[model samples]
Target: MRKVWVGILMFWAGLAQAEEVVIAALGDSLTQGFGLTQAEGFVPQLETWIQSRDASVRLINAGVSGDTTAGGLARVAWTLQPEVDGLIVALGGNDLLRGIDPNEVRKNMEGIMRAAQTAQVPVLLIGMQASNNFGTEYKADFDRVFPELAKSYDAAFLPSFFAGLSDGEGPQDPAALRQWFQADGIHPNADGVSLIVEAVGPKLEGLIAKIDAVGE
Candidate 1:
């Protein structure tokens, strides 16, 4: 009876530990928690949100300020340690700011997807739109890169991560964009991070369930 009880305890312990899921929010300053303290950035806040549900999901912020798609690609291998279960790819803003070729962005992002596939991790791509100032041709190309990649990769696609809060016409619908960003008009404030957490929480939850089922 003693031995059986010990084995049962061990099994439950293993099950408890298995509840933990590590999520990598890999991108630029946004991922780095720009304009906010470590606690306020999306990663920490997102973890809190996850905890509110399962209390076991971990969010790893791998944001690099001023990083381009190529930059993200360069570091993909090292960042995607096998223990990680999911990825939030929020890049290419710098590329758009520099007016880099959309083709380059697409290629770089594809590389990212390939690396994640090699690691057997699911990805959640955060798409960004080109600033309207960049001209229609450039805008179209930049916007197209994300959906194209999402479809090809079969990743979770948040059509506009910052959708309703987007720069121009988006925020006009009272209380849409203001709640997500600070006065600076750049980084997401704490409230904004909360909104993000709310938006992505369900999807992350579903992903976790799927992974758990497969592991079982």
Candidate 2:
């Protein structure tokens, strides 16, 4: 009876541990929560959002300010550690800002995905739209990379990280769009972070489902 009770306790403990999922968010300044407090950053806000929905998950902020796809690629292998259950690849804005070749961005992104795949972890790729400063042809090329990579890798995809923040009311209504952004018109403020968390929360739930399924 004593031995049987010990076995039961051990099993339950293991099961409890299995229920706790860890996810890594790999990206640039947006993911890093630039110009925001630690609590106000994307990762913490996202954690709050996920926990509010009753998910037993932890998110690691692997975001670096000004990191391009190549920079993300360089560190992906180390980022997908043994205990990490899933990955969120949110990169390429810097690449667009710097006008790096779209093809090169695609290659670096592919490397990151392959690294995650090789580690046997699931991935969620977040897309970024180019600003008009980059021109139509460049914008088109840069915008296509995320969905293409997501489809190719069979990873989950979120079309744009800033989805709900931009209402199509046009630049005439700066307040609608500007309200969510910081002074630089780039990084999101605390409220902007909340909006992003709300927009991507559903997709994150889907990714969490995948992680749970894999664990099972």
Candidate 3:
């Protein structure tokens, strides 16, 4: 009986550990928590938020400052290790900044999603909106990349990384959100990350639930 009880306990412990999923966030500085302290960065705050909600999910910060879609594609295969249960893809901001051709951006994004798919890891893709300064045609093409690929791959999707900062009428208004940004008029400050965490946290919860449900 004692040996049987020990076996049962060990099984439970292993099951509990298995339920705690590891999620890798792939992106640029936004995911990396640039211009902010380690604890105040996006991944940390997001992890705290998940913990607060009683989730057993851990986030890996795979954000590189100033990385474009090409950069993310370059690193994604290695990012999807066997232990990584899910991924949050948030690249393309720098691609927009550089006005890279939307087709190229889309191709890179496709590569990333395909890598995640091949690894059998689920994905939560975060979109980036292009500046109107890039031209309306360009903005339209760039904006379409994320959602379209998400559908193609059956991946979860968010319309924009900055969706947390929006007032719901339209795209993020710079003047309205000026206080939330750093001096460079880019990158969210600590407080801004808090707000973003609030918005993205629920989606993350959904991902965790999916991971648990599928036993991934």
| Model 2, TM vs. native | 0.90
Top-TM-score structure, candidate number:
3
What is the Å distance of residue 89 in model 1 from its true position? 0.9
Candidate 3: give its CA RMSD in angstroms. 2.1
Candidate 3 regions exceeding 4 Å error are: 1-12, 169-171
| lDDT computed for candidate 2 | 0.87
User: What local distance difference test score does each model get?
Assistant: 0.79, 0.87, 0.88
User: How well does each candidate superpose onto the true structure, as a TM-score?
Assistant: 0.85, 0.90, 0.92
- In terms of lDDT, the poorest run of 10 residues in model 2 is 166-175
Q: How accurate is candidate 1 locally (lDDT)?
A: 0.79
Show where candidate 2 strays beyond 4 Å.
1-14, 167-175
lDDT of candidate 2 at residue 106, scale 0 to 100: 87
Candidate 3 local lDDT, 139-215, one digit each (tens): 89988888899899888777888877776522467888988889998899999889888778878877776677677
Clashes of each: 0, 0, 0
| lDDT string, candidate 1, 104-181, tens digits | 999999999999878888888878877667789988989999989988877877665555354542234435565667
Q: Is candidate 1 or candidate 3 better by TM-score?
A: 3
Ranking of all predicted structures according to TM-score, beginning with the best and ending with the worst: 3, 2, 1
Top candidate on lDDT is: 3
